[model samples]
Target: MAPCPGRVGPGGAELLPGTALAILAGALLLAWPAFLNGYPLVFIDTVSYLAQTIVPEMPWDKAPAYGPFLHAFHWRMTLWGSLAAQVALLSWMLWLTQRGARGGVTPAAHLLLCAAMVALTSLPWFAATLMPDVLSGVAALAVFLLGCARPRLSRIEAVAVLLVGVFAVAAHLSHLIIAAAVVALVVVLERRVGSALRAAAAPALAILVLLGANLAGHGRAVLSPNGAIFLLARLQADGPAAATLRERCPDAGWYLCAFADRLPMDSDEFLWDPASPVSRDADGHPRFMGSVALVPEAQAIIAATLADRPFAVLRAMAGNALAQLALPQVGDTLPDTHLALSARRMVRDGFPPRELAAFDAGLQMRGLLPEVAAPFLRPHLPVLIAAVPLALLGLARGGREQRALVLAALVAIGANAAATGALSKPHHRYEARIIWLLPLAAMLALAPRRGRDPGLA
Candidate 1:
């Protein structure tokens, strides 16, 4: 790998003066909540991760990375420390992506880009949050940058970026799928792509981390017991699961037969509604929601659905992908009852009372909003939806290395959309999480280059 222009020291060590400043600036900007509320901002999922951390258990719905990361720093300052780390990691990732492209950027340009992202995108909101949602975006960028420019990266940069990317995937099950999709896309395009192995590295590590974590935490190696139910939820939303339930009732011996007509259209409602059949057994304990039975039932129903109406299933998946790309909303940021309970549990368990109290007070304060932000930022929903194809087209005009950079971003976006839509229902967050890659790519495309590196190109 070729070193960044003017960055390699006598021993081939790359200097990161600008990246350090960017990291500092990003930490300050993203940690605004800690200044406001004496702690970092947290979401419903944040509590869940914290709770799992305290229990040292693998949760059915979430991956184990964020919880452990949070736990590692919780005793020091809880929210702020973890959030500070998140900001630092995110800053480095942005810097690596930029540096990986066209050699490297100046400290001022790196800081400016970080500022632009905070001011022009929803990055700060995500970076400040306790959820793993933001990491999904960071992982996408890392996968693209690493995949397209691995040969140009220093050993230290390569390892750091790989760890960050893998951590992102390990933080969320959905993100694992997203990472896998990006890797697969890179592999398919490897002839034109630079390094599919670089892209695949994070996802591969994520799987290993998941298995290792589950084994250490739960005395098992399985990923998530709840996957099947999420699939069943998506199927229920599309009608086939319910149809199969009705057809297979009585003789099929599944308990879902009795309430097949009452199934909800929305995935959340079906999966979490108190009255929904999936939420409980006859004894009122959680049954199909996260039970082992869900796997077989969901698999059976999906297989039957595809066998019966393959075209319909495909059409629904396509629609789901399109719907997932719609405009993101402020309401998407709101916490729910379940998440609130999780937060309270975390507070009751180990989070400092003072910090929790400050967090409650901070919720009353209007935190930083992007100076020039809107309901939906520039390029809009439709444009973002088409960003991949457009990016690929634009990349065609560039040299091979530049094209590889852009193509990785484009492929990551497409892969995220497809995986999210097919494996799970299309939610705005699914697309919004990775959508920033479009604008990020645009910025990189327009940034002043130091002339392409010979090795990568």
Candidate 2:
């Protein structure tokens, strides 16, 4: 084939025009609101972005510090001009992926891969919204592109890898698991501890710096005891069974009781039963109950629970993971006039009061697509459900060469699920951005050549 346009220097790979086309397509989707009121998409993205910006800086007195880099990015992105920065970062990622994937057995295949990435990642909602999720996606793509460019590390390529590591770390601390997975995979494939260490060094340092800053500024590390105590307090007061507990343990710290109640249950199950177990205190009037409050005591309880009910914990974790992967609603932030009208009509027709109320509320909140799209999209649920497994299969077939990339993606997704699953209302969107890996992995699977295959060029 004739040399693709925008080919780099002799040894460097050339960029494909397809990449530009994909980016343009995404840009067009993002710009839809200029003509049509893509309010839902815009609204969802805005809320998520706003949450990232406002929630983190709520003063140490309000909420515990979590995902510091995500919060920082939100703060900085807005201050430095929001939408423009988002577009620039996305464009840079597209360019990087295209350039990095050049010369990797098939240029056209790589270009097509880029197109697939655009298609999968073109969630118009996220494109318009200024959230760390977009940055996280870019960081992930950078890592993947760099890994694909392996076996030859130019000075620039080496720098890119390190920068990606740092960016990934700073983009989301949840990225730590993914980063570690990638590094481990690289080490296993290349058998070069030095390269693996180098790739991970930047992110590792970035994490430490973030932790140091948190400690210096807020006097607490991420997930520090004080933070946990705060979360426990929230869980107790605003949580299920708060009323019952308040009546019993008027003077007792509900945080400990809430922790005890939730310790045995995953988030999903906890949502079902918001009330805690009640017991009598020394005064005997059915006081709110909890285990000992000492750190060692809590640790002992956790250890005992794990030891006695390992299977249950594993089952809860598995179920929570599945729930996190499934998209609950298509466009959560937008209003669907269609659903709202339907809900209103149903109410007029004397539908069950509670059911109609739920429908009305859902219509008002999520709009029609997510509310009504289910029936139409039900058949596709199988495909969505199979994503994680297919990805694992791709990893197995990808051999040692690509194992690192696969493992890194897996670790990131897994960690996110684990962490979020422990909290209340584990929504799919929390980890939705990572869904880009599904299509990316599928592209890798369908690629014409296996880099490690002995028969390949």
Candidate 3:
């Protein structure tokens, strides 16, 4: 084969100059967490994922891909292997995406841009963290590869892109829907601007994998418990769903009626709190409320509320959409609960005791850190909000293929925003997963100087 066919030129087996250095630079930048903390950083969800990896059963809501990957990495006694693997895969996929973009970029430029990402954006945070958020952004690049770079791809490159996209979808339930939504948008753009089914082949196969994985892991063929309950929880937090609950509870015989008065104003708090009606049982045990018995009631409330007050639902969605558009603050790192729970899980699962000791030792070194990026990234949400549309406009100024790429990114962001922002609730981490793409798109647009004219490029 042509030495690493994924990076090979048509002329010979030799890879692009500095390609290895660029990937190494990207990987080191992404693995900064491990370098500093002696382990990968984690979110609260990370504990559940770790537990899922060691435990026999799949989590009710979590997708199965990352959990198993973590299990495989745990054999080495620390999370460094998992973090390193994540950074390497991310670096490789990013290199492929940039290579396939318009004029392509020098490997030096790629390394410099990767450094910029580490410094200027939350790229390193998600990348180094033990969560699936980083993959969501990578999936966007895969979408572009499949949609705009198909003709340029060698067979190995095509397979790599398809696998990346599929794995991205398998990482999270919302990710699968978001990827599907982007693919749908690509299909529409192709119909309007002229592409081909070849562009969608990867995404189509990804959807099949998504369904199959869900079936295998959760014993269900659904994309994800239907998302109707979460949507209902969101509406409840926004006021109208609670109003509906109060009106229809006694006669309708729904469970949430009892606690409608005590529901939290925050969508995430309400949905995730142990005492919330969605997950709590009368006997005080945690219950999986996504069962068939609860779906119809949640669906009924959603249907009635929308039918009675359509404008209210739209207004709520808009508010959350705006919130999700803003970039997450840098201070939004893992909570103490995440560390404690993760450590507990490690001990319970008989993980290497020495690794846990090292982890604890690393914790003592925490102190008042220099405040450079956090101060600026917090209040500069407006800049981040403006960047996405500007990136799309910049892409439009390029050739036809770039315009299609722009559409694909827009749809991906829009669908993700709707799903995580409105349907669930606006959280920084939700949007952070995809917001890195705006800067990436801008970079790609500027890198192609020698390509066709702005109109034809």
Candidate 4:
């Protein structure tokens, strides 16, 4: 999109024609870890998303949208193409969001912003990642831009923002909830009900995408075939499900009556560990996301827990939500743990030999990513510590545009913590995915306003 008329910057600088070079440089900087790794970063969930290519059935654990997203960006050859596309999209969001600054952020200043994030935040790690984490931030930006920066955008940019927002929300279930919250805030604060509805339409569009994909691929029109399992896992991990199970074991007539004593395991272990009752077969093998009967049982358990012990469920969820809020820190963005192993094995099994070879050759697969990532991870907390207060100040005193962006970031971060922590598990990665927004919005809020555009028309 070209720069808006009457929107002035230092020396009356503009963008589109100007920001192209900066966007390119920023994209590379955003994906710096991948450049070092010689391959795009992979996560535990990367394989499941990649599996969408070959698997006919829609997975119960994750949304069906991201596998196709990776496919669309993968260029059919190397993942660097996907990484490039992801980071470029993120860079554009950063520039466009920053462009909402009072006079507008100059390309040089925008570049400085991206550089600061690469050095001090978790932006680079996710930007280069093959998973849907980068899209989470992109979705937040899309919500802010579509909801707050729409008038400044051309019809094309608006449509582009909507499409990007769809995939960003569709990439994960938690994203959908985060988007809904941001859209609501935009409506309430900006008073642009129409704009907020348009923003809300992104999640609607994302839902349609999942329905169409499921109908075409699996001959079913369901969204998230076993979505309740995530809730069940969360409740079980949080201690409510076990209490429910203990209360009504044999009479409940559920398959889980076989294992009521093993009350509350960690959500990850319940979902992935072979010993977990949710997934453990009679033969001792850990099945993928448990048996065919698991979803219904999971749903029943979740329902029973909420109905019987609503306070316990709510308290546990509240605790998990609070835990997640405090855990947006960047820890293990690039892993050397079992998650790394999962990605490695899945890539080897699901992808072509060449793709697997390149994956295996990456810094993570070589056991070097954690060490390489440590230095970059160190400064993130300190930067976030500074950014939170700046963002708060921006929300309190900055102009409407600044307030909207900062508030959107805060709402998305809070919503993400609540959703992922309460519905899935409280992990740093869940909140870390969207935490970069704080610094980005804070910088834009504090940016200088040189020109005459006071606010939107």
Candidate 5:
């Protein structure tokens, strides 16, 4: 049968010519923050990621994937290109997901959602910033939709979602965990959607990016060469490792024995401070954080800590994860005008002079971005809080598609908290990065089915 006029046909297979325009408009809407900043918003780590293009090795804490992605999209010119691409990808995912949830919609409706998201959620902030955090949510949604709602999506949309998920997994290790959780939840809750089991392959294969990067950088095929060091830092921050360190000091002859008295240091300080026991040498110089010798010892210490204080480990993990869930407020994303001399030098030497000038002149760099963004934070929290009941209502509708999306959002958000807060440290940006999906899920569940299109909600 011929499709009815104005209604999307066959799982949104047709991308009308105007759809591209709508997507671009949506992209620009979400990217308005970057435009206002006169440059992409810079996290303190932006410099580190950008430097990967010119630097010899990946930073211990960052994956090599996002840097290359940024470098390729930016074409070695300005960071704006990378921001544009991130915005475009986010726009496309939101559009397609909205279509699947609604069964179909006019381009105007999708754009309205984009505008609302920009006005009301932290989505725009993450989308506008030069960070892999944006892609974590993208990958979570992709996995669930492709796994549980593939029947509701066109072939083109399926391929695109898979590609997006691949990029996401390649870009960050935490995304790999998020994807795993989404697939696990979908497969468990909706086994009829058997593809959810198969969807795990994308993230499974994406691990090669880390393996390759590790191989090239340290001649190792490990997924994370410094993962143990990170785990140790988290354990120390959470209190378990301190006990182990105290018990095993001097007798163990570990490098960290010298700092046994300072067992429970903050995770960020343990990892980044030049004078930190984790990062310092006997002479007080900063050591390469990914030092090969540290990994095995860190692993040993973490294992001993877990053995000595299993309950403490569990308590810390739960506490940190719960703490992370409550910390979705947006901050620390503004450009740091107070970058260290080394980082400043890295920024200057990393980009062309023109790009450097634009970076320095951004509203964020000038410290004005926060004041402009402050008002939005007020509205953002309420919107997210409202999304809780809205998402529950969405589940009540019992449409597999909407239900899968809601479940994916919860799992992704929870998994992200565990990965970042339990294994690392709780931070606002971690949850803020992916919370936009709650509203998107609610919108989909409430969308009324029309014409021959299946009823969505």
Candidate 6:
């Protein structure tokens, strides 16, 4: 019996075998866990999640500042359960991509897209983490997919758009930067400021909801400008001023201190100064030990640093992003390799108890396949560098245009690489999540068929 042409809905069409395969592949990857290890898998963000779980009432510092939605979820779920939430989020991304493909793509093409996405192993690993990275990634993908799927969407479709926008804001503050860029693109393409403003309602509403929730839950706006200023201040301060800033703004300084603070002085020498103007707690420890309260004066310093060293900042960010992409793991432990193994042994055997404990906990894990995988990944570096050109080509190809998809792919890759190079360790797993999109973009670029343009539809 020939299948009655499987139609989805009023405008929906039949599914292709390739699309099914892609979805199945994604599902299988999502379900696989045998090779996964719990201890090493838990990155710094996972530690933040653990802290949140243990102390539900603790206000979020900058580290895991995902707000009440994730916090609420973490409070209710165990570590494994939280990991499941990440999986669910990954599934959401897959589903959104499928739905977004719509008229512009055949079932087979859609499936191929999904398969390509699944091929990016980093996506699943990021999904497995307890951090907001998965949520932000899903949100970013959703925003792009939704934009591609419906050019002149109905009210109901707008609701979905609104949800994506809201999720973007609530997921992670940094994602808002990407979302803003996307909105600007839509504005330029649509050529209607009013329409762009209307489209932006979703994200705006999301921001409002986040603020309202923060106020309701914590009795203050979670990421108030003042709080940000204070945090920045502490980040810029040096020596005695920095110490005073830390003492005054413990919450804002907590995450910064946890991750930053590379000074060579002993904790006792710096932290236990009796004559210092900074205030101390009951134990004679600095009151702002864990806080990251931003101060106006410190903000001025950060601003000056940026202004004075803009190029350096850019270079550092770029370098950090590259480093992060090359690094094996984002966690706070060194990779288990011959060199790292020897170093770990030396640290364990020779270092003092306190120093050894710190070194073991602070060192980042290296990648298992960096030497082999990095070269294969390097070809995709062009995709990031030439994203604008690739996107233009997608646009030129017209109907069922893969330009937006390609753009999303590039954004994911370029942003990941650029960001990792700038801020975090370079790890292949981190790059793996978005790297497959590069080849997919190239494939779309090479394909001969001119399908229905997503923009036109």
Best by TM-score: 5
Q: What is the C-alpha lDDT profile of model 1 across 1-457, one tens digit per residue?
A: 3322423322233454544665688667655534544446566666668777576555667788888787776663556777778888887777667766656655676678777665556566677777888887877777766666665566677777888888898888877766776677566655443477778889888889988877776577877644777877887788777777777776777767666777636887877677567667656776643445566676676677678777767877787877765634333553333534666567656766776666555542233232213443453454455555656665755434455567666666676776677668776666666667676676676565664332221
Residue range with the least summed lDDT across 10 consecutive positions in model 3: 1-10
Tens-digit per-residue lDDT, 1-457, candidate 4: 2332333223322345556788888898999989888789887777778777745345656787788777777645667777888889888878767755454556687789999889988888888888888777778788887777665565666787889899898888778888888888877866656776877889889889878876776577877767777788788878878888888988998877777777688887877676887677556766664744598888888888889999988888888899988887665667656755576766666567898788878788788877777776888888899998898888778766777788888898888888888888888888788888888888777776444332222
- lDDT by residue (1-457, candidate 5, tens digit) is 1111223225436556677788899999999988888888777777667778867456776777888888888866777888889899889888767655555556788798999999988999999988898898888878876776565666666777877788798788888899898888867865653475547756876787678888997678988877888888899988889888898888999988988887698988987677888667766877764345588999999989988999999999999999999988777676465554433565587768987788778788777888887887788888988989989988898465667677788888999999888998888888898878787787777677433222222
Give the TM-score comparing model 3 with the true structure, all chains together: 0.84
Predicted structure 2: clash tally: 5
Q: What lDDT is reached at residue 416 by model 1?
A: 70
For model 4, what is the error of residue 296's alpha carbon versus the real structure, in angstroms, after optimal superposition?
0.9
Best by lDDT: 5
Q: What is the lDDT of residue 208 in candidate 1?
A: 91
Per-residue lDDT over 1-457 for candidate 6, one digit per residue giving the tens place of the 0 to 100 score: 1111112333432334554444455554553331243212334444343443344444444322443444445443323444544555465355444444333344455456545544433444455444566554554455555454444243454465567557655655555545555555556544555546764665576667657756765566644433443323222332332443344444544333432343323332323344222234334565463223324433554555565556655664665565655553323221344434433343344335653454344323344423433343343445444544655676577234255556666565566565433433345555554454555454564455433423221
Q: Provide the global lDDT of candidate 1 against the true structure.
A: 0.66
- TM per candidate comes to 0.85, 0.58, 0.84, 0.90, 0.92, 0.59
> What's the true lDDT of residue 4 in model 5?
17
Model 2 compared with the native: what TM-score?
0.58
CA lDDT scores, all candidates in order: 0.66, 0.44, 0.67, 0.77, 0.78, 0.46
Q: Local error of candidate 4 at 265, Å?
A: 1.9
**lDDT-superior candidate, 5 or 6:** 5
* Candidate 2, pairs of clashing residues: 7-14, 40-334, 240-274, 336-367, 336-368
In model 1, residue pairs whose N, Cα or C atoms come closer than 3 Å (at least 3 residues apart or on different chains), thus clashing, are 1-151, 18-107
